[model samples]
Target: MDQLLSTDMDLSSAETDQRIHDLSGQKQSGLAWVKANVKEINDWVDRDGFALLRGLNIVSTNQFSTILETIFGEQLSQYIYRSSPRTALRNNIYTTTEYHADQVILQHNENAYSNCWPMRMGFFCVVPAKTGGDTPLADSREVYKQLPEALRNRFEERGIMYVRNYGDIDLPWQEVFQTQSRDDVEAYCWKNDIQCEWFNDGRLQTRQFRPAVMTHPQTGEKVWFNQAHLFHCSAVDTEMPDSIGADYLPRNAYYGDGGEIAKQDIDVINQVYRDLTFSYPWQRNDILLLDNMLYTHGRQAYTGTRKVLVGMAKAAR
Candidate 1:
């Protein structure tokens, strides 16, 4: 593969350019190249939180899966707790958030609201959108730094509580757990530290308590790790107020003790995310790898067709 080089300075700084590593015009392609440079690529990702590989030959889901396997080893994590609409392509590869073209997906760490989450995640851009559709990234470390002292202290002490009411209006319980049996879903939730209750109408309501800030296992850096802003009722108010009522929204967030998270606080958190976010237009054939604990990612609104496949691995305890 082409020699990877850092394109910018501190990744956490908003003043710096997006970190990208050119992997085009390489001497080797596919598994061979990935196997040889696995350590190097991982080191870059560790230091920068994310790396964008350009000019690779990956075009299909199979090829992307092969590359992911080479980097993350044979076993990869499954999308157990489905939050967004996605179509599974093949072999654990799924289409990136299947939301409407006009919708914006706020920045979040993959599965951050859960007790378990992937340590590493990757995205492959198969087809670039004609307009918009940039996969924006933000440094979680910076997010932590940007938060006000009082807010940070409050979050660390209270943690975060995520509440989901799953049914026809949102994602069905069967689909979220990838099982039709309610017993199986309950079992899965029990093992994952999630509390679940079945409503009289057959809807599933669940709640999970997770840390608002966590120390990265490898780097030991403290990062703002929860999805409170993304899951708060205010998010629905901003995005699709006409379509769903705040109480009927698929998910909402609160303090670990079940206290309401103020909308003003959510607004401040969203602003910090927007301020720290670094976005670049998607280029066809580009592959981006991220340390899920260190960086948060989001999707921008688009006008035309956009095909991006995603895969995750290395589950964090």
Candidate 2:
């Protein structure tokens, strides 16, 4: 098998002259070499489904976002506090079951339900999970080609229905997050363009509606997607939820009866993950840039103290 491409080649490009003016790496006076070779640096990312950008200490969110936009385009999602070092460290004390690609199932693409397109995503590992917490990734494009005709037709026509009961899972991380104030939560919702209602009890709630399948804006490849299974909050009753207890929220999915996929289908999908997945055991400095549409990722349970910082950016089309 051909070795997966690595970031060692002399990646110069025609656009390097123009790129110097657009990137901050040149203005700041450090990393001038990277700025001079900007096209090559960016091409490495464009050519690969993902890239492990080693040694660059991405401590500044603004600088990180700039680097991402330079390569991925301008429509990146602004950095938000997905979690803090102090908080993420506390949350990792409790491990959750592994699921591929974001907080949901092993589905392909991001924001499948919405017309809002995502070009790609960046995951910064600030705090790694304890033992056994490796991240597994797979090439969805390969999976798409290898999918059996029968399953392909069924999904092409019907898509997928994802359902989960997040509250029942009793993840401790949820408890730590409950400490957020109404305004803090509302700001978060607003930033993500989530429609939400604020309760008298100081809780903000909302339901997100998005497509279960998505077409890559450029490639036009079809992807199965839905946050219902991953982000458990996808279907929760945002209103009156803080009163009843956070876990009371029910995460569910509805699909055509009889024709809907079942556990058997999930098994097959997971099998694909197992076959195509590449894993990176967390190192404190590891930074992962993922082709959100082309690859899927997951996390596993672990035991030890892992500290990873994450910065998420959407790729540009």
Candidate 3:
């Protein structure tokens, strides 16, 4: 599963020749076409941390899954959004949705709450909404660069404390998976091999903890792993009697109320993130790949029916 199947999907003879001609003056590698293409792909990833492999006609889910494993390694299952037969129709009906990182963005790496790190993370948009659902990426490195030294030292020293209240809102995901049995939730936990404390007060609620920072296994880059969603949303319960949103704090960590962090710092980080953000309006058949580690993305609500399919892959170490 880790090794790529040498697919016969290479370009035609003329196409390869043309590509070689285009790169004639450039640094030439021994293996003419494929090697050169590989170098180009690597170069793009080196510069931008991600690449958009356009017009990939992935005909089936199995093929898609194989492709992701080939490219990113074996961690695709942890993050992949396995599309259903009705995925196209369902995505169309829910024409718009707000943006946020993965569920565990609220948790630390796979065992930061338990003792693991995610191998890789990615998403493939099968059908993009009509408007306002652009994938924006902000470099964490840049976000860290803009952090005040004192705040950095505080986070580096004390780290962050995160808490989540799933009881507050009936998230779409919760509802989608909610069943009379609560078995689905239990099954998910079991499959992931993580210990959990579950509740069923006419619904299921779960809480988990993780570290404030993570060290990337390959690059040794340390990423801020504070579960902003929990801290931000929890912190707001203090000053505002009635409000809901993600927030954080450098001082008290998990003060405030309802999981909201601090409004001021949240705004500052959001704005700083906005500075590093890049946007591409949704196109009919566009396919985008993301480096979940390097960039954080969000979505905006939109009108008109939109359909999107998503595939998450692991990152190659």
Candidate 4:
């Protein structure tokens, strides 16, 4: 086990390479070192919400899966209600968001818009991008504290409603549910508290109401946790032409009562994320472990190829 490093400690005066924990030396000891130090690692993550484990020399998806299993002590969670494309490398190991390298992914907790979500997640960087592509991490606790009192109160009171219209242009219902059978998808939706409807045109629509804030099961700390900004109409408006109406967008979010979320509020939330996010360039074989309820993660646009593998564990409601 290596010494735990605090991200809050001023690193401006220290050499850049000395800032993060380098656990490469522990490779010789293998999982034994991780097993012995699991408590320390968990405590660090609980305090910081995220930890960067660098230089483990993890080469393949199989190795990544093994390492994650050792840490999580269980099988990884299946990615249900997918928003981005990803290919499963093995049973649970997956390539992180298969979007274009030039696309910027906004910060959000994994599956925050859904009824159930993973309690923790890990990202293994196998290949570093030519430039940019740093995964930004933001403390959800800070996001909650920084949010305006009125907006936070309103969101906590009403919760959030996510609506999706699945079709060819966006992710199809089959792909999103990871099942070709409509009955299976419907069953999943029903079990997950999602309302599903089918259209005559072979389209599928679903609506779900989820909390905007959640108390961490282990720590019992309230954190801002929702994908309102990512699913808002303003997000679609920024990418698509003006001809597309908000209602016709692939996905959108509103208050739990189906009331509109103002664009200004969304902008404020985004700005707060930008102000609070902490980011670092990915180093090959660097692994990031996150307390999903306490932290949010996002991808920055890059110029070249970047391969980051991801896995999640400990599903919680």
Arranged by TM-score, best first: 4, 1, 3, 2
Predictions: Cα RMSD each: 5.9, 10.1, 10.9, 5.3
In model 4, what is the error at residue 27, expressed in angstroms? 5.7
**lDDT score, candidate 3, position 131:** 52
Q: TM-score for model 2?
A: 0.57
TM-score of candidate 4 on Cα atoms, chains taken together = 0.91
- TM-score versus the correct structure, for each prediction: 0.91, 0.57, 0.59, 0.91
Task: Give lDDT per model, in order.
Answer: 0.82, 0.46, 0.41, 0.81
Which tens-of-lDDT digit does each residue in 1-317 have in candidate 1?
A: 01111111124322354467666778676556778988888888877878887777764678888898788776667898888888877789989988788778888899999888998898999999998788888889999999999999999999998999897767888778899898899899999999998878777889999999999888788999998987887766455545766565688899999899988898788888878876767789888998999888888888889999899999887
Off by over 4 Å in 4: 1-19, 27-32, 238-244
lDDT at position 203, candidate 1: 73
The digit string of per-residue lDDT tens for model 3 on 108-211 reads 12223322333443345556665555555555666667766765555556544433333434232254333434566667646544333544544333333444
For candidate 1, report its TM-score. Answer: 0.91
